[model samples]
Target: MRPLTNTPTRYSWATILLHWLIALIFIGQLVLGFVMVRIESQRAAFELIQLHKSFGFLLLGLIILRIAWRLGNKAPPLPPSVGALERRTAPLAHLALYAFQLALPLSGWALVSVSTLEIPSMPFNLFVMPNLPLIESDAAEGFWAAVHWYLAYAGAALVALHVAAALRHHFLLRDQVLTRMITPSSAGE
Candidate 1:
């Protein structure tokens, strides 16, 4: 069977590496995020939460680099089998991720930075997370906290859709659709 897109030209090796790394970080974020919301805002829990936030911020940096790389490098075109609906949706999906990956952390940063939770953050006494420097009022912090959680929920939903689609392409479609992104380098894939 023929591939849907042209020989994958969209992602460079560096892009592929960062994509997978981001995926892992996002999965970790999901786990820790659940804990942060459901569990009490205890110091121990805060430690774990800080780990997630730190990694997410790292992802933030990488996502920016990935965007820069994508800007510079041509991505592999979608396979021919990819339908028009998918063609339209996929780009939006990627863009949504780019937006969320940044917004999610920044929102969280604002939340923790502003909230009076008094959690000991950052690992191994390395550094204290600098606050956003808000007024000692509840309304503002509460607003951003709500925004942070709401966005986290939205980002979670997007991840679910993203994974389900990948599985659909891999197992159901039985095409190189997933491989188009998973493949190591442009030349090899």
Candidate 2:
């Protein structure tokens, strides 16, 4: 069975769970974001927006925990099949991924916080999430909205690149890079 902590060659169960959960939700958010804007009914769009916001907040929380877990656990070394250039750049790419993952949700939150409409964000109909301390104005809203939109698309592109790299490592290079994330290492295996 997969242990709770990482092994030399594979991720811990916690890390695998967090990684897949974040990926699934982030992909769903991307789809939801694209579709919500095109909805003809304002009520339907509003509902979808609320749901997106709720998930965004949830993503932010999970990201924070993931970051903490990552910091506490060192990732396994890249397989020897990985080139030197890739070895150097992989960490940079990961940093960018983490940055976008963090910034997208924050920009969305900021966008709503500064909206002229002043609609309160009630996440999942559970409770109202307080807006960030920023001056509410149309200009601020526009700025944040642009930031959020750009970040979302850019983040999506980064995610695609990340997936491509992982696939290359798994199929092209025929390495354990991808499988390590999918399955935990067993002792003496």
Candidate 3:
């Protein structure tokens, strides 16, 4: 079996898998969020919203695992070709990505908790997930809903920036930044 740990020159298979999975799911969740909001029928909208909530909870778990894995493994170093400014900023950018990965779901969960509707989230329809113990208030619900919405947009922007940076590293800089994540070499640097 392939080792699941990262090396100095390339990310482990685990990291690669988690990264892509989160990216795909996040994109799908964004599309679902927009589509569900536009759903005209109340029943259809409720079902879609429930699905969205399930996926959001799933994302929360995946991200928590990813973060734990990342902390335990030493990530590959930035290529020597990378600039000083980029090197300094890259960690901050990553921190922001992790922050959003966490914040978005928690905010959504909180929003559901304080909502007057009081819908229970069943992740993947496996079982009922308890809501956060937040006081039921219209004002609180609105606040968390707004927070969730804004955070989603902000996270989307960060993802776009991340993709642009990766493309720049791949096409413009001709570096290993993008390749390392996609297809890490077995040979050590």
Tell me the RMSD of model 2 versus the true structure: 1.0
lDDT of all the models against the reference?
0.75, 0.92, 0.92
Error of 1 at 128 (Å): 3.9
Whole-structure CA lDDT of model 1: 0.75
lDDT for residue 145 in candidate 1, whole number 0-100 = 75
Full ranking by lDDT: 3, 2, 1
Q: Which stretches of candidate 3 lie over 4 Å from their true place?
A: 187-189
Question: Which ten residues in a row are the worst by lDDT in model 3?
Answer: 180-189
Per-residue lDDT over 1-189 for candidate 3, one digit per residue giving the tens place of the 0 to 100 score:
446798888888889999999999988999999899998999999999999999999999999999999999988899999999999999999999999999999999999999898777888899999989999899999899899999999999999999999999999999999999998546444
Question: Considering summed lDDT, which 10 consecutive residues are worst modelled in model 2?
Answer: 180-189
Cα RMSD (Å) per model? 4.4, 1.0, 1.2
Give per-residue CA lDDT, model 2, range 50-160, as digits (tens): 999999999999999999999999898898888899999999998998899999999999999989898889989999999999999989988998999999999999999
Error of 3 at 15 (Å): 0.6
Off by over 4 Å in 2: 187-189
